[model samples]
Target: MLAPFLIMLREGVEAALIVGIIASYLKQVGRSDMMPAVWLGILTAVALALFVGTGLQMVSAEFPQKEQELFEALVGVVAVAVLTSMVFWMRKAARSIKGELHASVDRALSGSAFALIAMVFLAVAREGLESVFFLLAIFQQSNDALAPLGALLGVAAAVVIGYGIYAGGVRLDLRRFFRWTGVFILFVAAGLLANAVKAFHEAGLWNGLQETAFDISHILPADGPLGSLLSGMLGYRDAPTVGEVIVYVVFLAATLIPFLAPASPATSRAAARPARQKV
Candidate 1:
């Protein structure tokens, strides 16, 4: 539940930020009459995301047991890849996102109405699609009823935050917010990597290195209340296999180090630009 909540909140806010920037640019350029096209694009992107998510779920429902495991494993791997890319991309893009978006809006406005719709659709669609994959992976890993509720709450909160920002009723250090969330998402992605490895082993696609790293089920079973929460959030396991443990450790080491490193000079300059300009 916690996993879905954070993922959705982050992704939702990102989509909102994209749309908000585009809207702001349009108004600034006295193109407010084209606002309907922006809303149309958002609605189309959202509908497409829902359709894709539903289609994937329905297709998975028809798979046999082994096939289902394989599918889940594939989904887990893709989810991790997508989530990791998103985190890193946002970190790099956040600084100049407003400028880039404004430029795109300018180009879009110079073109046909279709161009305007396409601009907004493509921007928001990326975020929506990313959210879909992450949510699908989370749903596959946990069957808790609270997962959907968490997603709803997260998205609702993101909407409020986005609105507040656009209305100039709220102020936040977006740099810090994204930095902390990026770290959290990295942790989640690591867990997804481990889970993917376990799923592969279960599906019989990975047979070598079949060894138990440790067994803590005797003390704290993963199904236990606290254990379940941890498992759902951090991919905790009672008795993880050797492959799972190794993959989990490697993922964390590789990603966390780079993520924690200081921002590049270009990135630092971009990040500092907004702070210098009084809102």
Candidate 2:
């Protein structure tokens, strides 16, 4: 529950931030009349995302047990890939997101209303698709109704926080927030990768690699509350298969090293300027 909550909170806050920036910019430029189109596009994106998630869930429910495992494994792998890319993309794009958004908005306004609508739809839909995919992967792992409830609450909280920020009622250290959250997400994705491999093995897609590396089930059962949290957030399997362990270690090592490396000097300077000005 806590895991889903945090994941959704971070995702929701990001979507909200994007929308808020667009809206704020529109207002600033005296183009508030076009705001309705943006809202419509956003609503459409939300509806489409919900439809896709529900449809996939229903379709997957009809599969046989083994097939279901395969489906879940596929979803887990795709979600991990998407989420990992998203984290890194955001880190790289954050510096120029405002300028890019403004330019897109300018182009949209210059084109037909349909183009403007498409712009808004694409922006919101990108985030919506990401959230739906991630949630689907999480739901498969959790198998608990409470996880969705937690996600809803997270999104609600994020909305409030986002509104506060946009309204100038709150100040956030956004760089710190994203940096910590990115690290957390990296661990989560690593766990998902390991789980994906386990699922594949269970489905007989992979064989002869079923050795258990170690059994810590006596000390930390994965089903326990703390263990579940860790498992959900950081792939903490108590008795992981050798393949799963290898995948987890490799994924973390490959991703984390580059992520922890120092940023380009120019990028560092640009990131620092906003905080310095704010201070």
- In model 1, the worst 10-residue window by lDDT is 270-279
Candidate 1 at 268: error in angstroms? 3.1
Please give, for residues 197-279, the per-residue lDDT of candidate 1 as tens digits. Answer: 87888888998666999999989999999899988888899999888888989998998899879898887897657534522
Off by over 4 Å in 2: 266-279
lDDT of 2 by residue, 40-76 (tens): 8889999999999999999999999999999999999
Alpha-carbon shift of residue 25 in model 2 (angstroms): 0.8
Candidate 2 colliding pairs: none
**Cα lDDT for residue 163, model 2?**
95
| Per-model CA lDDT versus the true structure | 0.87, 0.84
lDDT of the structure predicted as candidate 1: 0.87
Off by over 4 Å in 1: 270-279
Leading candidate by TM-score: 1
